[model samples]
Target: MAAAAAAPVWSVDPRTGKRREQVAVEATAAEVDTAVRAAHAARPALADRAVRAALLRRAADLLDAAGERVIEAADAETALGPGRLTGELARTTYQLRSFADSVDEGAFLDVRIDHADPALAPPRPDLRRYKIPLGTVAVYAASNFPLAFSVPGGDTASALAAGCPVVIKAHPDHPATSELCAALLRRAAADVGLPDGVIGLVHGFQAGLDLVRHPQVRAAGFTGSVRGGRALHDAAAARPHPIPFHGELGSLNPVVVTESAAAERAEAIGAGLAGAMTLGTGQFCVKPGLVLAPEGEAGDRLLTALTAAVSDTEAGVLLDHRMRDAFLDGVRTRAALPGVQAPVTPGAGGEHTVSAGFLTLAAAALAEDGTHDLLLEECFGPVTVLARYTDEAEVAAVLARLPGNLTATLQLGADESAGRDGAGRGARLLADATALAGRVVVNGWPTGVAVAPAQHHGGPYPATTSTATSVGTTAAERWLRPVAYQDTPPALLPPELREDNPLGLPRRVDGRAEHA
Candidate 1:
């Protein structure tokens, strides 16, 4: 990125409340244009499958070599401990290598072919279909996960794997860490004989808007708040040549505890819930924000256990002062509601530290939409709300009121309708759970997201823009579109879509599927 140097951007340490490093100056519109154009010019060079895979692998290697320095910068800016940051770096590199392996597999292309069928009513012609990469892509870094969701995050990794050059808009909270990771990726590209501009980086808020509006960009991927993500999504849509925007905005991640499960293992559920809620100072996007449990002896037991565990957790620092203020403001607004109980008040304890907390309220309070509506919004800190339900109907009603979430978990008993279906109350609960969430967890938490083939980190509406995932192997599909050829000469067709199937890819032909 061309540094304007007009104004300096400082990286502040959240723990000590002081500036750590001057990363880079903000990028102007002209600089943004230059960076994006450079990325667009390098698309063909990055399109080779072997080269892309090697580039990603090299990036993983470079990150591993610079792990100590990167972790130190991330810790200084975000105040996430060295241990957690190390694990996050591991996950980030693992994600890059996983995408590299997917590129090597070649199945992500989703190629198909069909010979001409004269016996049909309309006399069909030969057709071949395969997914192709959109041109240049814009990636918006997330603030919560500095390494995994920032410069070398999943969005950037998957886009590169899909043959799309990326122009990253670094999040302001960790600009230093973003710069470090960006340098590593560029070095990896250079090592793999790829262009330096294969991955472009820009800093500043308006530069992000300029990136999505740039005509050369064909798609975008974002991970952030609902307000910010929605604005960018709308901007991408409003463009003359509108692009596909895949954004994981926000989620409440509501969880329901069955009476049987609570009775069987109330202490276990409570302990797990406390740990997940306070993980990363409750800054994780998938942290559980809402809990619905029956108001009974079992529920009381779980609450007692959860409260004890939460109270024992020491306060931790937020990512920045603005986030700390927003978290406290959210807590205060919710606590001011009538009949709301704060087991551990989540308020700003010091100049930069915040305490973990949980709120309690009757489930019926959400049935009517008023100030109680705040309960549905995501509070991005170490806090959660427990809604006590009088009966299963109340739980169902509460679930209906919730927005789409990344995950919804159910803690069930060992034999609670595990096999029986006719009168097994589990079916109804499962049905309700699947309606509101993408991944329904059974007797587990949603804090740790696994990066695998079947994993989907998205849901309806507010959770994400579309059903597509921002993680896992299928994520590359978001940066790709399908094109079908009809009766084209084999020599003129791309090798992957040729009649001879030179690439050895599995393709559907003559109404029959082939997988190899």
Candidate 2:
């Protein structure tokens, strides 16, 4: 018999369990440094707002025109369906436009000028300050949102918008798609006369490490596991001249269904959670991995509804083999815990798919034992562990025990949800929930991240490193730092900081702040 052609290098597709393509991994430290230098050299021209906005608009146009091609490429490489890919592409384009709009708004410049006035008692000096680009950014693409968080994702877009060149370390899971998107971005940059080297990508773990450690890299942006994010964060911190590392590490996003809310509409909440937990196979950083529903008949009812809803949905394939194996392993680990029951045991729905389901554990077991704490950690798959609380006190205690998260949700009824009951207790509960997360959802699932200026898509601790800014429009702030210039001549001052303000941007002039 003739020899079979080496089984066409295995690559899993999330939508359909099949091989898509064989990705080539070839790059060395020298090549990476060359790319970074090219990007660094090309930074100044691309830093202009008009130039960057035009590049972003060109990218959005390309995404719109060739969206289908991009979607197909992503779906083939990731096993994600067309429907999901389509939505992700839209989000990616929307994000590009959002950044472009932010550039036009000029608010991201954040200009503040304390003009010289020796006449005052304190004799204030000409302290003119504004944000400046951090040279080059090293972005680590995510496996789950290949397009939206990948080569052409928010990190690259935001970095470019902030006038910093980007060097992306593509995720190995979907390298082909990453390459394709990189090509499109390069073409877009070329079209607008922006340097093609403004954006570069590399594949492989070693390459990622090298990129992070590259001396010229001014700052970093990451969206991945806590382990990976922390490693990069530590590396950046340990560097000779340490740079800021803005990472959205990981989160066991928790949802609390107050006793009254569960009693009012258990079924609706259960069904909604099923969708959230399994959306993209529970790969989102904002997925409600931990749910706190008060115990008693109401909690049981919510559990039952959740079980039925999750059981009905077919198990979807995770991002890659590593994630799939981890999900299965996590589920098994949690199930082995005492007082934990998988009312709906997740199973392999298809060749590469795993079913969606929930596991129930008593609040006491989680509180009393350290083993159960593992159940609270993120499994990164279509599995949620519903911790049943016997009463409000137990719920509060468990809430207190939770690590900081990207989002904390509370499902409340008309009376309780209003936060203005006759007894004035509702307001207290609302305030308490808001304090626990970066984004607090009153009655909705936390999975859907809306692209808006007001959104704060970050949280405390392991959820994110520094809590001063968010990962939305505010994410640009991370790549730029404020520098104050004092007692400088008009000729020496930056055009934006001069008394006449040629750019017509908002600034604090004289003693009063004004916007033009």
Per residue, candidate 2 scores C-alpha lDDT tens digits across 1-516 of 973332222345655555666765545787689889988988997768989998988998898899888888787777678998999999999999999988987888889877667899989877888998988999999888888888888888888999999999988778788887888899999999988789988766777778888999999888889999999999989989988888888888888888888889998999999999988777788999988888888877888788888888876777876777788888888888888888899756777778887888887776654778897677888888888888667777777777888888888877876755665545666666676778888889999788777878888878887774444687788888888887777898877787787888877665576888
lDDT of 1 at 432: 88
- Could you give candidate 1's per-residue lDDT for residues 206-248 as a string of tens digits? 8999999999999999999999999999999999988899999
Q: TM-score per candidate, in order?
A: 0.97, 0.95
Off-target runs (Cα >4 Å) in candidate 1 are 1-5
lDDT of 2: 0.82
> Candidate 2, TM-score vs. the true structure?
0.95
Shift of residue 244 alpha carbon in model 2, Å: 0.8
**Collision pairs in model 2:** 13-79, 14-78, 14-79, 15-79, 15-80, 295-389, 315-354, 315-355
Model 2 regions lying over 4 Å from their true place:
1-19, 420-425, 468-470
Best by TM-score: 1
